[model samples]
Target: MRIKICGLTQLEDAQIAVKAGADALGFVFYPPSPRAITPEQAAKIIQQLPPFVMMVGLFVDPKPEWVTEVLKQVPLDLLQFHGDEPEAFCQSFGRPYIKALRMKPDFDPEQAAAGWPSARGFLLDAYTPGIPGGTGEVFDWQRFPASESPSWILAGGLTPTNVAQAIRITQPYAVDVSGGVESSRGIKCPTKIHAFIKAARS
Candidate 1:
């Protein structure tokens, strides 16, 4: 299973995550998020990351100019849209992006993903009243769609202790963790990061 360590802020933490067998590193661009990092900061961290490690940028309902500006500065391998962004708008960037869905009782994964056909994958996260993502709460794992396509990324409330169980149940193409391995709002814990990845893989 692929592991994506998200909400990364410090360079040391990024390095630690990468070394601990992370497949991708996510940098939040949404200002409202406590885990958000500036383009300059992300750029510096990205430059130092070793080759083959994917760099992801997380955005929410951003303006075209802002996304353009971020792309020019930060060399992101993927774009994660965690809010209400239309397919046309998402495709206009000419980069690979994944659409994040906030899980509700009646939300349809394939039906909602149908619009963004260009999306590289779909990330299923927990729904909160005002939160776009990173709520640190797990939804019903049984809600995972029974699709043959290898494009589902499971997220929300995954930790070292429970990631193995989550993966065993969902069998997602990849797994994304933000707060599960975090020591604080934005800071990642190396011990947690290492433990999480090890557990997920096992």
Candidate 2:
């Protein structure tokens, strides 16, 4: 399964995630998030990372101008829309993107996905009141959509301890984590990173 390590803050943490075999590294751009980093900070980290590691930029309901500004500074390989961004707005940036869908009560994955028809994939995350994502709470894996037509990226509250089981149950195209591998908020633990990747791919 492909692995995406999110909420990256420091360069060392990013390198360890890459070295530990992460396929993609996610940089948070929303200001309200504690893990948020400036485009310049993300650029410096991206510059040091070797090619072939997909760099993802995470955004909330951001103004088009803000995205343009970020694109100018960081060479992001993917954009993740983690809030209530419409399909037109998402497509307007002219970059590949994935839409985050919180698995709230009665959530219809297929119906929601129909909105972003051209999305690269869909990230299914746990739902918490007033929180967009990164809540570190796992939703019921059984809630995973029955149809596999669209690529589904399983995220939220995944750690080394349960990742293998999650993959076995949900059979997702990819898995994403943030707090699960962190030594603390915005800080990743090398051991956790290695262990999580190993567990997911095992």
**Candidate 2 residue lDDT tens string, 72-91:** 99999899999999999999
> Where does the lowest 10-residue lDDT sum fall in candidate 2?
142-151
| Candidate 2 clashing pairs, residues 3+ apart or interchain | none
- Residue 15, candidate 1: Cα error in Å is 0.3
Candidate 1 matches the true fold with a TM-score of: 0.98
Best by lDDT: 2
List residue ranges in candidate 2 displaced over 4 A: none
Q: What is the lDDT of residue 121 in candidate 2?
A: 97
Which ten contiguous residues of candidate 1 have the minimum total lDDT?
141-150
- Candidate 1 per-residue lDDT, tens place, 43-154, comes to 9988888999999999999999999999999998899999899999999999999999999889888789888888899999999978998989999999998895739999
